[model samples]
Target chain A: MLPILIYGTTLGFTLALIAIGLSLVFGVARIINFAHGAFFAIASYTLYLFFITLNIPLPVSMILALISTATISVVMYIISLSRVRGMELNEMIITLAFTIIVIELLRIYFGPSPLGVPSFMKGGITIAGYVVDMQRIFIVVISIATLAALAFLVKKTRIGIGMRALAQDEDAAMLIGVNREKMCIISLAISAILAGIAGVSVTPIMTASLEGAWYALLNGIAIVILGGLGSLVGSLIAAFIIGYAEIIIATYVSSHLKSIVALIFIIVILILRPSGIMGRHHEIEERV
Target chain B: MKSRKESNKNIRTIRKERLDRGARARSKDLYVLMSYEDIAYVILPRVLPPLILLAFPFIVRDTYWHMVFFLAGYYAVASMSWDLLGGFTGLVSFGHSLFIGFGGYFTAILNVWYGVPIWLSIPIGTLAGAAMGTLIFAPCLRTKGVYFSLVSLVAPLVMVGSILAFAEITGGEEGIYGLENPLTELQWYYIMAGLVLLTFLILRKIAYSNFGLVLQAIRDNEPSVKVSGINPVRYKVTALFISGLFASLVGSLQAHKLSFVGPSYFYLSISVGIITMSVLGGVATIIGPAIGAYILTILTEWLRWLGGLRMLLYGVILLILLNFKPEGIYRYLERTYQTFERQVVEE
Candidate 1:
């Protein structure tokens, strides 16, 4: 029971990091970045390529990996998403297509097998007679730090305010002298970096593979839906809910049934409350 | 200098005009055919593709190409089904494989475990598959545009997990195998060709009908449709059921053709491929999606030598097409087909 609690909190924090990025992108851009998964996978793969394969120092490799993730996210938006900005369906398709390309490229180069990454530290601590690795603890700590920084960035920073303005009303924000394209590109880059941070920090424990893209994406989507589409606090709460739910299922139920929890949640939530637990979009319900 | 002036005058006098051949327009809405050429012009475009498709078996002697046609036929039917709900109705489902998988699995279970004959199992599976699809998707219809699409995308993932959890019945990754394949290759080919024509004609008929217009209206504006004394949900549900029927039919046929059924049937790639085909050929046009399916399926097979790079290239091509040719191939072809140029002298 203690093991489940320890693991669930760790999983919850990791999900919060990943999902918050997805929420941020969707909230600001209204472009469901299906390629957000690719950002997650690409960060880990780039880290693997630079750090392990190319013998770069770990810190530099992590930074380069994150930079590449940001570059890819921006490039993706400019090339495909920018044209179909307001067309919701087209945005989804383009992002989904981009995801396929990225995932397939990773598969081609890295092979389908999961690649192992050595943890940053090599020790364990015992809590309540349960063994916890330093990497898992690192994941928990880094996730909280990143999330707090993100909260500050959104709440207090100039760019973050621009992003918030864009999210609230695009035309109104533009009328008020907000740079829409710049905000979108910056928010997208930041979102990618957040996903990158999650990918880089957590891959050592989980191992990075092509499938991680889809797993990260699905979990991120599950959290976003549960929290409400664009609500940060909602996403944070929903992330923990899903994380603990996944861990508990893996612990007690058959591990194979774990992924279904999110999918089931999406279906049930959409059916019962399209706006989600903390979603303020009552218009969605009325449309239904 | 004198001859040059004459040539310029002639060029100015004889302006080229494009007109519909063999028909005289009485007004914007009415036309009278001046000759048999007009009748042929009206009928030929509608008939030629199907006639060519029917004649394909005789023209193409290679067994390998025949197999390719069979595969193309499966995707063709699937994409057309997608176009009905997605194109005509404006409900873009990202997990259409749910219907196909249900159909395939139902047939597999019935034939393998219950001793149901292939003849009975196929139709039963198709009906049951469609019914199940309507039931599962009915709840999701309440979700607005993007939300419905998202729910659809996730629904198949749930099916995949459930299959794995209930591995004993579903056969997990290995899936159910050794179902009956009583039909000969040619027989299967003819059936598929016939199905392609039947589905195309039927869907086209529906799309041009009053019912289809209502579906399109609902897609454009549900509230307006509701205000017009139409129940959008009823029309949407019927469209889903009809779409599922064809999707299920092709799925059951493919399962029988392979003598196997597996979780791969519900793969996201398959659903994505269907969407790609629909978008490529032309959404809202039954014939266009079929063409798209054939092109993509053949292109995929042609690029098989690239191995994993095949999908990467496919994605790149789709992205390029979506960006540059968002209107699709059929619309372009239709524009070229419906008009001809002739010289007319100005008085």
Candidate 2:
């Protein structure tokens, strides 16, 4: 039980890190940004390339990868997403298309096999007589710190205030001098960097592979939907719910059933309450 | 004002007009044919494409190329099915491979495990698959827009996991094989061509019919449809069932043709491929998606050497198409074929 608690919280934090970016993009831009998963893939793949292939120093490689990911995210917004801004369906398709391109390109360059990345701090620490990797513990601490920093950034910063205004009402915010396009670009970069952080931290545990795109994508979508499309708080809570549920299912049941938990959650939540747990957008409900 | 011909001569400006406009004006409220040109105009487009499709197998005669055409025809039929629900009814499904997977798996299980005859199992499997799709989608039909799409996108991923969990029955990663491909390549080709023609004509009829109009109205505005005394859910359900039927038919046929059914049948790429086809051909046009499917399928086959670069190409093309010609090629082709242009002077 203690093992489950420790592992679940770790997993939950990592999942939250991956999903918050997706939720953030959807909330501000009203775009699904399907390529968001590719952002996660891009970060880890670039990290692998720079650190392992180029022999760059570890810290610098990580920073380079994160910066490159942010640049690509903004470029993607300017190139593909900006053109089809409000057309919901086109945005989804173009982004999905972009994701396929990125993942396949990674496969072409990196080959299909998963590549191992060494952990930041070697060795494991025994907790309550069960040994846990130092990396997992590091991930937990880092994720919490990042979340707190993000909260402060969104809650108190001028950019955060403008982002909040844009999200709540785009036209009203525009009237008040918030730049819509600039906010979109900034939000996309921030979201991509967040995914990059998650990908970099978790790569040692999961290993980096082409499948990570789908993994990140499916989990991100699952959490975002269950948490409510645009609600960060809901995403945080839902991520933990799925994280703990997955760990418990894997522990008690067959490990093969792990991924099904998120999918099932998505289906059930969407069917039972389209507006989600904390969302106020009952507009999704059927009329008559 | 200058005379029309003089004005046209005065300015070297070009004016575009629909050639059909003249034919339409001539044929208004009448049962008479103006000339052979009129008869040719109406008859050629409708008849020529089907005739060419019917003769394609004979025209090609090569087994390898025949196989490619057969695959294209399968995508064509599936795209048409998708067009019915997504284009007409506005229920954009991102996981259409679910129906295809169900259809294939049902046939495989029925034939392999239950000892059912191929002929008997195909129809039963198709029906069962369609029913299963309808049942799964029925609950989410109440939710609008991306909610339905989200449910659809996740459902197939769930199926993949479930299949792996039930490895004893599903054959796990190796999938269920050893089923028979009883039909010859030529026979399969003809069957596929026949299905494409039948689906196109039938879906076209439905789209222009009163029932199809109601579905379109639901897509455009559901509340107005409700105010007009139509139950949008019922129409949507029927459309979904019909759409699922064609999609399942193609899946069952493909499974039998390949003599295999596997978890990969539910891959997201297939769904994305069909959506790309529908959008490229012109959404909501029953005939357009078929054309788009054939074009894309052939293009995919031709780019076989590119291998890894092929999907990248698809992404680029989709991006370019969505940015530049979101209306798709069929609409553009139709306009060019039906319209004529002339230079005219400004009045």
Candidate 3:
């Protein structure tokens, strides 16, 4: 039971880190950004290359991954944003295609085999006759710190206010000279950096591979759907719900059915409540 | 003598008039005019392309590679069917493998348990697929866009799970095999080729028809279609049913070709592959998906040397294409062909 609890917490924190970026992107951009998983996988793989292949220190490797992923996200935004314009469906399709390309490129270069980064903390802590790995504890800590930092940045910064305005109304924000494109780029960069940090933090525990894109994508989609499309708090809450549910299901039922079970939950939730737990009724205007 | 000469002249003129009318009717109805450019650019090239493709197996002489071509042909047909519903209708079903899997399973079961001949089982499977499509997707036509896609995606996953759970009938995860007919591989290739050609012709006709136009209308705007006095739901359901028919036919052919059927044949990735082919070929175009399928299949076969990197390549290429050429490769080819024809006509 203790093992399950630790595993659930570890998974929930990792998922929250991934979900926050997606929620931010959805809130500001109104695009699902299917390439979120690709960015995550790329960041994880970059960390693996830096730490395992190049013998870099874990902290430096993690920072490098975050920076590189941010740059790539900026490049992606520049390339796709103009073409997709105001069309959310086009944005979704373009991102889906982008994901395919990124994953394929990784497979071509790194050869599809799973790569792992060495755990930063080598030991564990004992609590009430139950021991928890130090790496798992680190994941939980970093995830909380990152989430707190993100919340502070969004609530207290000028750029965050601009992002909020843009999310509410792009044209209105532009009329006030909010620099919509710059804001979008920044949002994408922040999202990518968050995903990168998550990738680096979780790589030691989960390992990294080309196949990570689909798994991460599924979890991200499920969390975003369950939490609400653009609600940060909701995403955090939904991540835990899903993470715990999946871990519990895998333990009680069969591991192979985990994905199917999660998908079923998503379907049921979507049918029953499309707006999700914290989502409001949104008037979706036809953009294109 | 003067009256006889006059009558002969009149008779000759009347006969000549009749012959002229007959020739005109034949030319108008049967001998469609190929514009000089069309003759030079499209007609000449297309007429012999099939013959050339047919001659390929003869030249290669390797049965295994010929089998690969046959498989490619089947996939081309399946992908095109997917394009018709998902691309043209904008339904974006992620559960198309359900139709294909059902078709294969039904055909195998009918052929094995009931001793039904292969010829009779194929149509039965096709109808079953159409029925399943109506049952699953027709009701969801009221739901728009992502909702429809989400439902369709879940449908296949559920089907697979149900198939696995009911091991008594479906043969479970291990899959069903050993149902082979007495036909040789060469005969099967010919059968597959014939079916592919038939499917292509049928889809081309559908693309040119008013029904196809209505499907496109429904895709572009459902409310507008409804306001225009056309039932968008009916048209969407029809498109799904037609797509299912073709998908099932191809699935049945696949079962016959492989002499084995499995759940993997109807997995999510297969649906993803179909969507990839459809989008890569230029959605809403009749021939684009087939070309997309053929190119991807060949690319996949060649990239086998890279092991799992082929899928990665597929993803990357899809992204690049989506960014740069949302209209797909076929649109570019069509434009080039049109320009060449125009130039020939001008010359």
What Cα-based lDDT does every candidate model obtain? 0.86, 0.86, 0.76
> Please, what are the lDDT tens digits per residue for candidate 1 over residues B129-190?
98987787786686566766766777787788779988999899899999999998888899
For candidate 2, state the interface root-mean-square deviation in angstroms to 1 decimal: 2.7
Off by over 4 Å in 3: A1-5, A87-90, A126-129, A284-288, B1-62, B93-143, B147-174, B205-211, B226-238, B262-273, B295-309, B336-347
**DockQ for the candidate 2 complex?**
0.53
Query: Can you give the TM-score per candidate against the true fold?
Result: 0.94, 0.94, 0.81
lDDT at A187 for candidate 3? Answer: 84
How accurate locally is residue B135 in candidate 2, as Cα lDDT from 0 to 100? Answer: 83
Clash list (residue pairs), candidate 1: none
Stronger candidate by lDDT (2 vs 3): 2
In model 3, the fraction of reference contacts reproduced equals 0.31
lDDT of 3 by residue, B84-122 (tens): 877777777767787888888888788766777888888
Say which candidate scores most in DockQ. Answer: 1
Superposed Cα deviation of residue B142, candidate 2 (Å): 1.9
Compared with the true structure, what per-residue lDDT tens digits does model 3 show for residues A1-288?
Answer: 887788888888888878889889877876667788888998999998888888888789889888989998888888765677666556665676677778767876787689877788998999779988888899899898998999888999999999988777778989998987778788888989888887888888888986677667777777776776778888899888888887987899856566665566666666677666777745222211
Compared to the true structure, candidate 3 yields what TM-score?
0.81
DockQ of each: 0.59, 0.53, 0.26
User: Could you tell me how far off, in angstroms, the CA of residue B281 lies in candidate 3 after the best superposition?
Assistant: 3.4
